[model samples]
Target: MNIDSITNGVVIDHITAGAGMRLYELLGLGELDCSVAIIKNVQSAKMGKKDIIKIDALIPIDFDVIGYVDPGATVNIIRDEKLVEKRTIDMPELLTGVIKCKNPRCITSVEQELDHVFRLTDRAGKVYRCIYCETKAG
Candidate 1:
């Protein structure tokens, strides 16, 4: 195993490799004006397989969008080669514009002009339903 060191950046760990690009697209990382190091298919002690994203700048997190999609992920803020903050995200019940409804027939999915909208069922339940088509997330 080869672990390269980053001088300064935030490292997102334990992301699913398949979701890596989707994560980037959803987070608007590619559009951002910053150097980003995206590492996928890394060996992990806990996850067995994992992906990591290193951003060479501080980006304020949209926690509501993050928690719902990447609960298994962790964000480690780096400063001068040291980890400044380690944030473990919990599942969020409510979200807006982060994910499209999986159901093809859902209005949000069908209508490119409309933004995806979700309603929180129970904060504790972490359950959300789409507003346009009323598709429940299981």
Candidate 2:
């Protein structure tokens, strides 16, 4: 599907192919209930299979999701169909309440629906370690 562009809001680009839906959930976009355009399995020169999410409302980004998924993804804020804030997602120093720490022995598992916390161990390596159990994930 070809879209001209969103009149307002933000365009999240360079998303990992399958991670598009997860990104939406991780950021709680479902709760916002806004008009969102999710383009999956799009051809990309840089990334073999990429995705683009265009939200129709002006919503503040949840950077934690970006840090967990593709730290290199770019967030382009659009206003009146004009490029405004173009930011490349950077690996966060610490990640909390974002991704679930994959440690069974970790305290997060003991508590139900506990906010998962992690740390970006290697920015260059795209590695993350659980803050609770200190387990390396993704």
Candidate 3:
């Protein structure tokens, strides 16, 4: 509960409860050599309970992954212990490399060099379909 404020870093907020670890893994935060904090089930007036991730370093992050995982999440850039920018994550219209095509007949299955791509076809249903095979992503 005594997480220190970062001098310069990114704060991922409003994550759905129990999703902090998945985001951490998906973002490859474990590979970084900087202070990273994952706070889960924190009280939130709007969301009841939410998760937050604070990285104590200014590093590049894949916003697509964040959008896919938690579209409502917010990214706050901190510099000199002050918030410099705030970005609201929204579901990306196109996704590449964030998820893999599971269809066995898909080209990506055989072509190891091919990037698994998907397009948001139904925003209301949060549905995505593979661009190559048209197979719906789970």
Candidate 4:
């Protein structure tokens, strides 16, 4: 109810109501020493109900992971208490290290150092398949 405005940081907005925590963990915000806020199920006119993550620090974010998890999310950059930039997320065509191939036979599973790579196979359905074994990403 009384969330303080960030002086310089990013505000991740319009998260699909329950996906805030997933986004928070996936982004490795837990490793940071800065203040981070996860606001869930907030009333929204455009989205009906939404989740928001407010990072009280400016840091590099993996857009691919964010897009893959929640394509409808938005990122707002706040600088000096003013919104400086706003970004709308869309599904990524290619993803690397954003998700893992669940297939046990996938080369990535055997090669511990190999990056988990996936390509968009069905845009409308948001389907992605592993590049090595063609295993569908869950």
Candidate 5:
């Protein structure tokens, strides 16, 4: 309830209520050495309920991963305990290594060295298809 503000770090805000943990895992935040806080199910006027993630260290984050998990999320950069920049996430057109192709016959399954890639096929539906076998991502 009393989370301190970060001086130099990134804050991921407006995450879909239940999607924060998935985003956290996919982004590999658990592997970082810095302090990170995940606040879930916070009341939000706009979203009804939302999740927030605060990182206590400035580190490189793959925006594509955030976009893929929660396109409506926002990223805030803080420096000197002040907001330096704010970014609204959008679905990415291409995803590489963010998700693995599930198709058993897909080349990625056989060729372990190849990167699992997907392309946005339907923006309206947020459908992603594996580039290797055109298998729709689940």
Candidate 6:
């Protein structure tokens, strides 16, 4: 309940409830040496229930990964214990290497070196189709 603030780091806020761990795993936060905290199911006036991730270091983050996981989330950059920048995430128009195409016959399956690419085809439905085979991304 008592989480300390970071002096210089990034905070991922307004995460959809129960999505903090998925974001953490996809972002590979566990591999970092800095302190990281994941707060789950925090009551929020706006979101009802949300999650937050605080990283105690300034590290490069792949926004595409965050968008893919939860586009409704926000990113806060803290410097000298003050918020320097606040970013509202949106669904990326294109995603590369963020998600693998589940289609077995896709080119990515045959060519291991090919990066899995998906383009957002339907923003309303949150649909992403593989660029190689036009297969819907799962």
Each model's RMSD to truth, in Å?
3.5, 2.2, 1.0, 0.9, 0.7, 0.9
TM-score of each: 0.75, 0.84, 0.95, 0.96, 0.97, 0.96
lDDT of 1 at 42: 86
Candidate 5, poorest ten consecutive residues by summed lDDT: 60-69
- What is residue 14's positional error in candidate 3, in angstroms? 0.7
Candidate number with the higher TM-score (5 or 6)? 5
Model 4 stretches with alpha carbons more than 4 Å out: none
Residue pairs with clashing backbones, model 6:
none
lDDT digits (tens) for residues 91-131 of candidate 6: 89999987889888787888999999999999888888999
Q: Tell me how many clashing residue pairs each candidate has.
A: 0, 0, 0, 0, 0, 0
lDDT of 5 by residue, 1-79 (tens): 9899889999999999999999999999999999999999999999999999999998988999998889999999999
lDDT of 2 by residue, 43-80 (tens): 99999999898898889898767866877678999998
| Candidate 2 error regions (>4 Å) | 111-115
* Poorly placed runs, candidate 5 (over 4 Å): none
lDDT of each: 0.76, 0.83, 0.93, 0.92, 0.93, 0.94
For residue 56, give model 2's deviation from the true position in Å.
Answer: 0.3
Cα lDDT tens digits for candidate 3, 13-101: 99999989989998999999998999999999999999999999999989998988889899999999999999998899999987888
Model 1, global lDDT: 0.76
TM-score quality measure for candidate 4: 0.96
Please give the RMSD of candidate 1 to the true structure: 3.5
lDDT of 4: 0.92
Displacement of residue 102 (Cα, Å) in model 6 is 1.4
The residue pairs found clashing in candidate 3 are none
